[model samples]
Target: MVEVADDRYATGSGASPPLHAPRPEVEVVTAAKRTRRQREAATVITADARCTPVLVRAAIVGKARMPRAALEILAPNGAVIGNVALPNTSADFDLHQRFWLVGDPTPGSVVAIVAEGGRQIILPGSRLRSGPAEGQDWSGVACRMLGWERRVAPTDAPAGFQAVFSSDHPTIDGPGFTKAVRRFRTAAVTIPLVFFGFCFPFLFVIPRLVQSGTSTLSLLVLPVLGGGLMTMWSAHCRREVAAQAELVEGGAARWGKEIAFTQSYWASMRKPSAAWDGPMPAAAV
Candidate 1:
């Protein structure tokens, strides 16, 4: 019989560890770093607006520095109607007096502000309809900025566009108030259902406990059912809110990239051609 060398029992300076030896585990963690532009984008202070059928006016406030910022008015189909240059200053400016025409006055129109460094802000638009405007039969869209009067000065919008910002504006109109009312109505309906659901399990559990005159495993069922229902409802509400917030955030980011691309295209288009180079002579070699 031939004897094979046993490396597991070998002890020497060059000996390697056994194959069955356990190796230590290490966890590596990496964190993403945000650029200056991303930091500026995430710090949007607030964007407020007052919309009318023909005109859309808005104000944006922030703490970042945006040079040569311009507001671009977009049509319902995402076509750029025009862009108005904003003052070159910090991001804390207002557009109280500035307003633009819809040209077509179609619904679903939106507004965006793009700056030199690709910083952009998008504001939601209001729905339009036929309503009373300054004692005249006019059909237009109107949306008032929430808490605008308390935060900023009264809007100096033109006469025809003034009614949208006042109390005369339609109660059921504008996405601002419409969304608020919808959420309120939802809460009003769901609160009662949740309360009844939590109590519903108790009604049967208590009656059985009283009749039996002894504690049983069925007692755990009421608490478990009630807790599960509440947890599910709370999770649903949280997911809804988070989804809406993410939609707004994703839209803003996408719009910013588009604006940056458009700006670069225009810049390249306007760039002057370099001096023409003379033709090289092939015989010089």
Candidate 2:
């Protein structure tokens, strides 16, 4: 195991962490309600679109450096975009922004997002070779020393091509996409049902029993009825299940070997660990 001699994660205070780049476009307004770093990160992604979209293939890399203060987003003109704090995740990234691609660079602009600190983001036409980070890798490792969990070999891209996460990139092109679809299916079913089941008694049974306190039988019957209602609701949501399955099939068709990588990452970021109400890490980049 590679020991982080300078394990930034070792700290408990609201200090910066190891790995990733910083945007020079924005000034950190430590006065804001968020950690100084998080606020600064959010400001960078949205300001001047400091993250202007380009047609670049992206790959993850890690480099050890003297930990810098949470990065600042720099303006194209070399001025700070603004002095403000922000939520951790990229402000505007949504279902449409996350994707993987295998094609030429296309004309026109899309929003580039800053996520997972500054290290995780989409670059334009990078053509970086990719392989697993924490898990096993069949391909040879590039550099174990650099923190970049994955290495992307650069490539020259052609013109007039485009891909979107929901559309082209799902065709099972790589591990990223494969993980995406699998996670989506597992989470889609688990998340809602888990929460619904937990809340059933308090939200439904208790209320009904309270109103029908007139009879002891109401207590027993209401509980059963609530359970039945929950079962019915789950049954009624088969269409949602089908939709998830369809996306799984669709991703394989669209991206080939890759699954829905972006979707999965997004889901993980949004999902609470341990419990539904458990606080999540600032959206994993």
Candidate 3:
């Protein structure tokens, strides 16, 4: 069997072993093919669109401690797909509806593999099971090979939508007045420039008027005028900042509402009797 250095090569006993000492030419060709397959990938909506699908490029199969583990892809399938490795842990796959496999995958298809734990692995078409019986569930066998039970409901569909709870909501600061305060704080930095602009021009003009025989009246009056200008500018900045803060609050509320709606929508579309536990037929070449 062709072997990868270190942990990648399989070492345990199995019902069927990989091809021993594959021909050099065949190995080279397979490696090239695997490289090419990793680049082709697509994200699919599965489980009645309850679960978001992620594609990947490659995978690694090995044991973590005494339990089996897998590292696979969840991105663009290509000549060399990237994969994430997950260790086996105590998690019930059956509860998560992890029994389905993409049936009859073409030469380049995305495959999702659930590990013993809650962790999942996605791999490209190059690493899939080859020469399987028609209409057989490869996901079950893959789970068993990883030392896990084939626990899946035949017709239990996932709930339709996901919820956006306040606890998990994304926020910059607090709600209500605090949000306004944050915006005002940001504006404070820029408002000073406006005040300075008026002050500088008045300082130059007032001194010229004093020297031009105005008995320095312009100098005295300019300070009061500049002060008034500064006050007005500060008010303007505060108002603008507060307006921006209102936008932030409104936006957050809108996002939260959308997420809640998505959850409810998915929940309503669930089909409790739809069975995905059946065998996934062998992929086509």
Candidate 4:
């Protein structure tokens, strides 16, 4: 049972407790093997999806508290790999999950006690269970392990352990937005350039011609055409942005910004049903 210094951690709540010992169900693996981070990630937030209530004892180390009380999980590279949007009504969470682990005691560091397909994993969720879209029914409570105040339990002990996480979804089973992102990448750059290209003629060329007192009527067509094209290009860029948003909406991609949620009313968390725990027998949990 390793221990982390209390000062090394911070969260929405003040000064969390010292780390808890690791769970017996955790999976320990080496970094050399391929990871299961992408596979076990939430594809979509649905009631039918396997829900779990494993305790999460890690300290919240995000840059700031999310608008909806969400705890954004960061990867080793700091790119978002996953997020647990608290059961806030306005938040756009694609999936809700929870986890905890004990391994490294270094404050702010992640311990990979749980593993999936050889990859270390952690559930960064609170049992304030919730989802997007109205009429969304949840298991009633979204639960997450908070604080290091070790609570002695008879059969099941509750302790907050440190298991770090990440967000920013990756492409599933394919070229991971290679084509879509590429197309938009081109449009983002080209559209702006195209608009300015036309502006050059309209601002300079047309103005000079008009000043010369030449029959500006015929040349007026250039500005008109340019203006039309610019309008179309602007529209195209906006549409692309919408399309991108749609693609990542559900669990396809991960977000790095604060997501709004109907202020998650803080509450006590109950035990969650197991969604996924590496190599654990059903009877054990």
Candidate 5:
């Protein structure tokens, strides 16, 4: 009887079979494609509009760190309606930052996030996530990110209208006023210190030198020179204070305008038939 040799058991001159079948060679190309799609989806910006003010969330990823990135909300006509600065991110990681768009975006509008290195991401407004903002603690996040100068609060109006106003009022005890006062006090204190610092050496040295038989007239020149320098420094300090005061005044004016605009905006939103007709008034300015 012709019997075939048991080649399956033979290992001396032939390669042995794998203990288990290879995991049907993982399709690297297909897997890569799937990973790419998932990453693209994850990085997309999503919007939430159930609340009064619209909010947008972006998941930024990659090796680049964009410290100066800004989110720009565009109208359907391509005009920039709102811009929010994003927080800093480290290299080779993902960061999620959200901002409330100043005004509602119409359908077909787009959102773009521009990074410092010219990297920009554009997302269509159609990718909005439908949900209510009632349970979400978005205020806390806004306060942390936008600071007191630009914070939003819920209003007593119906339909859950919200108001965006600055906490830096122009009153005497307000943040803006207090900051200006502090800067003035700093300048007041520094002016005297600088004057004394410049005169200290001459005041003490000249007296001793005069007593030691140095020419009294020559020593007098030193104090006069020190006085001249102190005068120049004082004038410079005064100019600096004036410039700072101008800045404070300008900021106060801006603060007032913002408060007024917000009040008007809120009033308009409260109307039954009123809709966001255009971008924020402040944004236009």
Candidate 6:
């Protein structure tokens, strides 16, 4: 294999890994001179507003750099118009916003969005090209990046062509609430059964046996019952531990993928890793 020297690929603490590098630069002729543009977009001005009814195609380009877990579109002057979400596995998730498209959208229009770091990015249309990054042809069917802009139908839009504003902020899960809920729901079924089966002999079953003058039989049954209950509870606890482990493992996997995706999104745009949180200047329409 041929070794290649890469300088732009290295960076700081939060720098994305190598495989997550941004798309390479494209050299296109302008005024008989070479101008290189990377095929990626970032979010800008994630506000909500009213917009004129216009139909168009679009795709989400980034999930990180998104102002919120969801993204909304704004007009050139910063008016809310539409919204959409980064697509998940099954559902067509959407952000909430109200704004309008002034013209028929094509391949290179800049869509306004609010990125994760609370700054704005006026994402350019050119970032989305025909093929995958390696193909060097970004001419694929247009689909908005997640946590970015989205297309909307005039009829499906809010009254007056305005859209609502929404987002899944604080991007990370809160206070382990989800984990607690899962533990509670699961234990609801297992805990009661364990107690009745294992500890009830010392409370009710033994007393009943003594009152009935069946102490010997009680002695024989209680031990066996107690042992079986203990075994079942132990098994249940083991399963719970395994399930919790799987959950933690899954979360780590998701976080890794998100980090990778974040890097790829900006790298595709040819932006430095710090740009995610750096200042973004306003776009001149």
Model 2 quality (TM-score): 0.25
The number of the candidate with the highest TM-score is 4
For residues 51-166, could you state the per-residue lDDT of candidate 5 as single tens digits?
12233332221111111223334333444444333322212111222223322343233222322111212222232222321211222222122222233355665543332133
lDDT of 3: 0.32
**Global lDDT scores for all candidate models:** 0.32, 0.30, 0.32, 0.32, 0.32, 0.33
Worst 10 residues of 1 by lDDT: 135-144
How many clashes in each candidate?
A: 1, 41, 30, 28, 0, 49
lDDT of 6 by residue, 1-285 (tens): 001124454566556657767533321111111122212223322233212332222333444334112233444454434443322211212223222332223324433332222221223333222221221011111122222234344666675433222232211232332343244334433555765676666666666777788767657665677667666754454344334323333333223323323323332333221122322322211
> Mind giving the per-residue lDDT tens digits that candidate 1 earns over 1-285?
001123354466576877886422211110023224322322321222222222223223211112122333444455544433222221122233233232223433332232211111222222222221121011011011211112222577687665543665433334533354344334434564777787787777686776878565667666677667665654454344333322322232222322222222222222212221122111110
Give one digit per residue, the lDDT tens place, for model 2 in 141-213: 2111111123232344332222232354323334443444454445444655665676666555566667766
What is the model-wide C-alpha lDDT for candidate 1?
Answer: 0.32
Question: What lDDT score is found at residue 23 in candidate 2?
Answer: 22
- For candidate 3, the C-alpha RMSD (Å) to the true structure equals 22.4
In terms of lDDT, model 6 sits at 0.33
* Model 4, span 1-285: residue lDDT tens: 111123334465666655894533432221112224312222222223332323322222322132223443343344433334322111111222233222222333332223212123333223222222121121111111111212223444333221111133321112433344334434444565776776676666667787888787778666678668666754454444334433433321122111111011121121222223334322112
Comparison by TM-score, 1 against 5, better one: 1
CA displacement after TM-score superposition, residue 176 of candidate 1 (Å): 13
TM-score of 1: 0.23
The residue pairs in collision within model 1 are 128-141
TM-score against truth, every candidate = 0.23, 0.25, 0.21, 0.26, 0.22, 0.21
Looking at model 4, report the run of 10 residues with the lowest lDDT sum.
256-265
Model 5, residue 79: distance off in Å is: 50
